[model samples]
Target: MRNLLNFIIRYGRWFVFAFYITISCLLLVSNNSYQQSIFLTSANLVSNSVYTGASEVTGYFHLKAINESLQASNAILENEVLNLRHQIDEYKTILADSIELPPVAKRFDYVQATVINNSVRHPRNYFSINRGAKDGVKVGMGVVDQNGIVGIVNVTGDRTSRVISILNETQHFSVRLKDTNFIGSLSWRGGDPSIAYMEQVPRHARYQAGDTIVTSGYSTTFPADIPVGVVMNRIHGSDDNFFILKVRLNSDFRALSTVRVIKDEYKSELDSLQSFDFSPTK
Candidate 1:
C-alpha cells in the first residue's frame, strides 16, 4: 500500500495534466459551434464509409442467389412471350382459314419450368424439372427451351417431373428436312449431346449439308416446324434405300437452366378420334 501511494504521488501531476487536457478539448468542442459541427460531420463520414464497405461485402456473397432468382423470373417472362406469339399465330391462321377454308389449325400452350438436374453423358439420360401435376405438368408433355425442343416429360409427381432427354438412345423424335420436307426419325447414338442421327430419309430425297431439320408435328408432344438441328453429314446404308444423316442439335444440354413444358389441351380428344384406325392391312 505504501509502494502504491509512492508511485501515485510520483505520477499524480502528469495524470492530472492529461485528464485536464482531455476535459478542455471536450469543453472547447461543446462551446464552439463550428468545431462541434466539423466533429459531427467527420464522425458521420467515417461511420457511413464503414457501413458501405460492410454492405458491399455482404452483397458480393449473395450474387449467386440473386442471379438464380433473376433466371427464374426470366423464365416466366420468356414463357409469356412465347404464349403471346402462339396466340398471334393462331389469330393469323383463323384469318387465313376464314378466307380460304383451309384445314383446322392446331393450338398449344407452354408452362415454364426450371431444370433441377440434367445429364448429357449417359446412354439413357433423363432430366428432372421443378414442376409436375400440381403445376399442370403431365406425362407425354414436351419440354423445350429458347433454342429448341429438349425432351418429353415421362414421370410426374406433385411438385417434380422427369424428362427423357432427346440425347437418350431410346428416345426417338420425328423430324423433317427444312428444305425438302423429307420426314425421318431422330435418335441419339449415345455419342455426343450435340449430335443425333436422322434415319429413314429416302435416298432419292435431296440432301444437303447444313440444311435445317425441324419437328414434323407427327407426335402430340412437339409443335410443327420447331427447329431441332441442322444436317451435319450423311451416310448411305447397305440397302441403299435410305440415308442416315447426322444432325447438330440446336439445344445445348450441358448448360440447360430453364425450359418450358408444352401442354396439348386437345390431345386426348385427338387420340380418341385417331384410335379407330390402329389396325393395319397385311
Candidate 2:
C-alpha cells in the first residue's frame, strides 16, 4: 500500500494531464458540431475496416465448404445436360404416334468429395477421395471435376476411396471425338500429366488441332459426353489400322481439390447382364 501511494505520487501530475486531455477532447467534440461529425466519421471508418478484415478472414476459412457446394451443383447441372442431350436427339425423330414407350429416367447423380491424396508422376497413378462406399462411391464409378474427367473409383472403404487416375498407363477410358463421333480408347504413357493418347480411331477420322474428345457412353462407368481432353495431333501407330491422337486433358491433376463421383442409375442393371442366367437350369 505504501509502494502504491509512492507510485501514484510520482505519476500523479502526468495522470492528471492525461485525464484533463481526454475530458477536453470529449467536451470539444461534444460542443462543436464539426468536430463531432469528424469524430463519428473517423470512428465509422475504423470500425468498417476492422469489420471488413474480420469478414475476409472468416470467408477464407469457409472457402472449402463453398467450393464443395459449387462443385456439387455443377455436377448436377452437368448430369442434366447429358440427359437432355440424349432426350433431345431421341424426341426430335418422333412421328407423334401414340407409342407408350418407357419414361426416360434421370441417369446420373453426384457425390461431392475432397481429393485427400493425389499423384501424377507415376506409371500407375492413383488418388484418394474423402468419400467411400457409404457415400455411394462404388468401384468403377466415374470421377470428375468441374472442368473434366478425373478417374474411376478403384477401391472403396467405409469412408474413403481410391481412384485410378486418367493418367495411369494401365487404365484406358472410352472417349469419342466430338466432331467425328469416332470412339477410341484413351491411355497415358507416364510422363506428362496434361497429355494422353487416344487409339482405335479410324485413319480417315477427321480431326484438326484442338478437337474435343469426350466420354463415349459405351461403358457403364462414365456418362456420355463428359469431357476428357482435346486432340493436339496425330502420331504414327505401330499398326496402320488406327490413328493415335495426342490429347491435352481438361483436368489439371495437380490442382484437383474437390471432385464429384458419378452415380449412374442403370449401372447395376447393365453390369448384371454378364451374370444373367441364360442356360436351361432347374
Candidate 3:
C-alpha cells in the first residue's frame, strides 16, 4: 500500500492532466453539435461491431445443438415418408382389387445415431456411431445417412457401435441399376471417398453414365431400392465379359455426421434358414 501510494504521488500530476483532458474532450464534444454527431456515430458503429462479433461467437457454440435437433427432425420425417409410401402402395393394391391385403408391415426400423468417429483414407475404413445394442443396433445392420448408403454395423457395444464403411475395400454389397433389374456387386478400392466400384454387371445390361444405383434387396441387411450412387463411367473388366462401373456415391463419407441404423425385423429368421446345411456328408 505504501509503495502504491508512492507510485501514485509520482504520477499524480500526469494522472490529473489525463483526467482533465478526458473531461475537456467530453465537454467539447457535447458542446459542438458536429463533434457530438461524430462521436455518437463512432460509438454506435463500435457497439454494432461488438454485438455482431459476440452473436457470431454464440451462434458457433450453438451449432451442435442445432444440428442434433435437425437430425432428430429428419428421422421423424423419414419414418413418416416410409409409412406414407407403404400406405400408398396398399391403397394402389386396394384400388386394383386384385387381392385384398392388409397394409404391408414395415421391413426396416431406423435407429438414428450420430457419427462420433469416421475414417475414409484407410484400406478398411470404419465408422463409430453413438448408438449400440442397447439402442437396438446390432451386427449386420445397415447404416445410412440422409443422402445414401453409408456402411454396415460390424460390432456393437452397450452404447456405441462400429460400422464397416462402404468405402472399405473388403466391404461388398449387392446393388442394382435403378432403371432396371440389373444387379451388381458394390465395393471400394480406396483413394476416393466419394467414389466406389460396381462389378459383376453383365455387359448386356442396359445402363449408361448417370444411371442411379440402389440396393438390390438380395440380403436381409438393407431394404430394396435404397439410394446408393450414380454411374460415373464404365470399363471392361479383366474378364472382358463383365462391366466395371464407377459410381459416384450419393453420401459424402468425408462429411458424414448423422446416420440411421437399419434394423431388419426378419433378419434373424432369414439367417437361421440360410444356415441350414443341405449337402450330404461324404
Candidate 4:
C-alpha cells in the first residue's frame, strides 16, 4: 500500500496532464464546427461499415436454410404444375373422344432432391442425390432439373440414390419433336457433354433447327412434353430412311446440383398388366 501511494504520488502530475489533454481535445472538437462534423461523419462511416460486414456474415450463414426453403417451395409449385397438366390432358381427352376413351389420369409425382455428386466427362456418367428410399426415390425413376431431363435413378439406399445420367452411353430417352407427334429415341454418343442424338426419327417428320425435343410419354417413366433439348442439326442415319437429330441438351450436367425425381404412380400397375397371365390352362 505504501509503495502504491509513492508510485501514484510520483506519476500524479502525468495522470493530470493526460486527463487535461483529453478534455482539451474534446473541447476543441466541440467548439470547432468543422472538426465536430468530421468527427461525427467518421464515426458514422465506421459504424455503417461494421454493421454491413456483420450483416453479410449473418446472411452467409442463412444461405443453406434459404436454399432448402426455396427447394421445398419449388417442389410445391412443380406439383401444382403437374396437376394442371393432368387436368389439361383430361380436357383434351374429353374433347377428342367422349364416347370411347376416358380421361387420362395423373401418373407421376415429383420429389425434389439435391445432387451431392455429379460427373459429365465419363462415358457412363452417373449422379448421386441426397434423397433415396426413405424419401420415396426408387430405381428407374426419372430425374430432371429445372431446364430439362437429367437422368434416371438406378440405385437407391436408405438416404441416398445413384442416377444413370442422361450423358451415359447406355441411357436412352423416349423423346419427340415439339409441336409434332413424331417420336424418337435420345441417347448420348460420347464426346460433348452438352450434345446428344435423337435416333429413329423418320426423314419426313417435319422439323427444323431450334425445334425443342421433349418426352414422348411412350414410356411409363417420364411424363409427356418434359423438355429434353433443342434440335441443333439433322443428318442421315445408318438406315438412310431415318434422320438422326443432333440435340443440344438443356440440362447443364457440369453445373448440376439439384433435381426432381419423377415417381410414376401408375408404373407398377402398368408393369403388372404387362405381366398378366394370358396362357390358357392345358
lDDT of 4 at 260: 92
Candidate 4, position 240, lDDT: 72
Report the number of the highest-TM-score candidate. 3
Model 3: per-residue Cα lDDT over 1-282, one tens digit each: 999999999999999999999998987556422222322331233433453455444435535655775687589789999999999889887887656568987778999987766679878787777677789987789998877789988766666676788988877999999969899999999898888999999988998799899999999989998889999998779987788999999887776766899989888888999998899999
Error of 3 at 78 (Å): 9.6
Candidate 3 yields a Cα-based lDDT of: 0.80
Q: Model 4: runs farther than 4 Å from truth? A: 1-106, 280-282
Q: What is the lDDT of residue 204 in candidate 2?
A: 78
TM-score result, candidate 1: 0.63
Off by over 4 Å in 1: 1-106, 277-282
Q: Give the TM-score of candidate 2.
A: 0.65
What lDDT score belongs to each candidate, Candidate 1 first?
A: 0.78, 0.79, 0.80, 0.79
Q: What lDDT is reached at residue 102 by model 4?
A: 81
Task: Name the lDDT value of residue 164 in candidate 3.
Answer: 83
Candidate 1 clashes between residue pairs 3 or more apart in a chain or in different chains = none
Summarize candidate 1's per-residue lDDT along 8-75 as a digit string, tens digits: 89999998999999998987556422222322321233433453455444435534654665577579
Supply every candidate's count of residue pairs whose N, Cα or C atoms clash at under 3 angstroms. 0, 0, 0, 0
Error of 2 at 75 (Å): 13
